[model samples]
Target chain A: EAAVTQSPRNKVAVTGGKVTLSCNQTNNHNNMYWYRQDTGHGLRLIHYSYGAGSTEKGDIPDGYKASRPSQENFSLILELATPSQTSVYFCASGDAGRSSYEQYFGPGTRLTVL
Target chain B: AQSVTQPDARVTVSEGASLQLRCKYSYSGTPYLFWYVQYPRQGLQLLLKYYSGDPVVQGVNGFEAEFIKSNSSFHLRKASVHWSDSAVYFCAVSVGSTGNYKYVFGAGTRLKVIA
Candidate 1:
């Protein structure tokens, strides 16, 4: 079983506040992703990293930034949090060497921006 | 643009009843289809995947999905439903090159199994 864990499972922040969500994976997967889940939007990718120190923008990366400091850790940062940015965030890791292209996800973090 | 669509946002079924959740995709090239289930307050779990060869793929906990190329649909089905099976199900499509693959997910279907 691939293991992915997230920190600060629940967070509350005010507008203009900076927030960071951390994720750690033990699967040794090279690909890590950050996504936000909303009521009708499902999961929208915000940022992804192919490996350590390589972060790429995804579909909805405007208000979010990602950092992959090491192979086991990834973080999503919100420079200036807004109420609109309030959503459940998920982190996922995938191994490109695998044929299935399956991603293992972490228990999401629920963020509330007031 | 490539996209995945799950028409039903919510589904209600009684225990022991059959189940089916519809999913459709719009893509030009061959697609890698997947069905994932998210339990309450938990991460998404891979239920099944269809890359090639088999149109019908079996997943964990008696769940299965079938890929129909003609309709661009990959509908998940279960022979018998259980109360514990209630969860949000997502359909996704893998696109892009092998190393640079990106997944496009649907809005998801929230299933409610009543005993």
Candidate 2:
């Protein structure tokens, strides 16, 4: 079955520390996205990739950076983590065309920055 | 700019009762609409989506949504609710024919089913 997975389901980091979150997708989709879910605010996109070596800033990309080293792997990096950045992160994968825009999501990663 | 709105912040219903979650979108042009459910400590899963064709679309777990273009609303409903149905429901929107449109999601409505 097509699936998306994220590692380090729970993490606690100090402010100004470097944090990396990883995701893998077996869906073989061309598009991948990283979103943060917060209370009273819905899922907001941080960054996305069209494919390998392609990363694009999303709605809220100020404090985050993303890397797509390969077709199946995408990583979100926080160079200087902050308490405000603590939230549940979700990674998703979708197909290329408009007809296949529906995305599949990972289990989600809980990050807490002290 | 495109946006999605889920008016109710929370809803509580008794088990075996009916359920309806309201969702509205603000997009002048035709758009894709979807309903996603998130269980406690879990990620979101698609419940149903409406692009074209029938105003109503059926999804997993006996869920369904009706797209009313005139009102710009896509409301999800279920005839009978179970305790397991308690979760957060989010409504999202995007351009249907565009390949790069990022989905805009609503704040989400937390549904509580009391036994």
Candidate 3:
């Protein structure tokens, strides 16, 4: 089974604080993504990376930035966190191997910004 | 722009009962459809997907879905649901080629299974 692991499963931050969430995948997938989940709002993509040193903005990328330092690691950064940024964040990895359609997600990080 | 609509916000069913979660998509060309389940405090897991050929596809945990191109719908169904099946279900669609990996998700449907 493909394994995607995320760090700091639960987080609490004050407004204007800098917060970072990390993810690692052993599946050797070429694509990684960040998303936030909210009640009644569903999951919305924030950022995605094609590979190392490549990051692309998603539908809801305004207050978030993503980094892929290596093929196995991806990080979501909140430079200046705010109350609105409080939500459950998920990291996912997908391999375009004949099919870019399916994405495997890691356990989410619940962020609370006061 | 591509979009998905999961009209039901919540669904309640007794254990061992049949299940159906509605999902509709709006996109030009052949669409790539998917269903994912998110358990409490867990990540979303792919339940099933439909690309072409088969109108009905089976997934894990006795779950399945049927694609009706005429109505632009891909509804998820389960013959006998278990209590562990309670979770939030998301319907998603990717426009154009799947290689592009662009996806649009619905608001989600929360399922509550009564034992």
The candidates' DockQ values read: 0.83, 0.70, 0.75
Tell me the docking grade of candidate 1.
high
- Whole-model lDDT per candidate: 0.93, 0.91, 0.90
How well does chain B match by TM-score in each candidate? Answer: 0.98, 0.95, 0.95
Encode model 2's per-residue lDDT on B7-37: one tens digit a residue.
9999999999999999999987777888999
Name the weakest run of 10 consecutive residues (lDDT summed) in model 2 chain A: A94-103
Residue-level lDDT tens digits of model 3 in B12-98: 999999999999999987788999999888899999999889799999999999999999999999999999999999999875444
What is residue A44's positional error in candidate 1, in angstroms? 0.6
Q: Write down the TM-score for model 2.
A: 0.96
Which 10 consecutive residues of model 1 chain A have the lowest summed lDDT? A93-102
Looking at candidate 1, what is the lDDT of residue B63?
94
lDDT of 1 by residue, B1-115 (tens): 9999999999999999999999999999889899999999998999999989979899999999999999999999999999999999999998887778779999999999998
Error of 3 at A87 (Å): 0.4
Assess candidate 1 and give its lDDT. Answer: 0.93
How large is the interface RMSD of each prediction? Answer: 0.8, 1.3, 1.4
Ranking by lDDT: 1, 2, 3
Top candidate on DockQ is: 1
Better of 2 and 3 by DockQ: 3
- Which digits, one per residue and each the tens of the lDDT, describe model 1 over residues A12-107? 999999999999999988888999999989999999988899999999999888899999999999999999999999999997585368999999
Error of 3 at B41 (Å): 1.0
Provide the lDDT at A98 for model 2.
Answer: 28
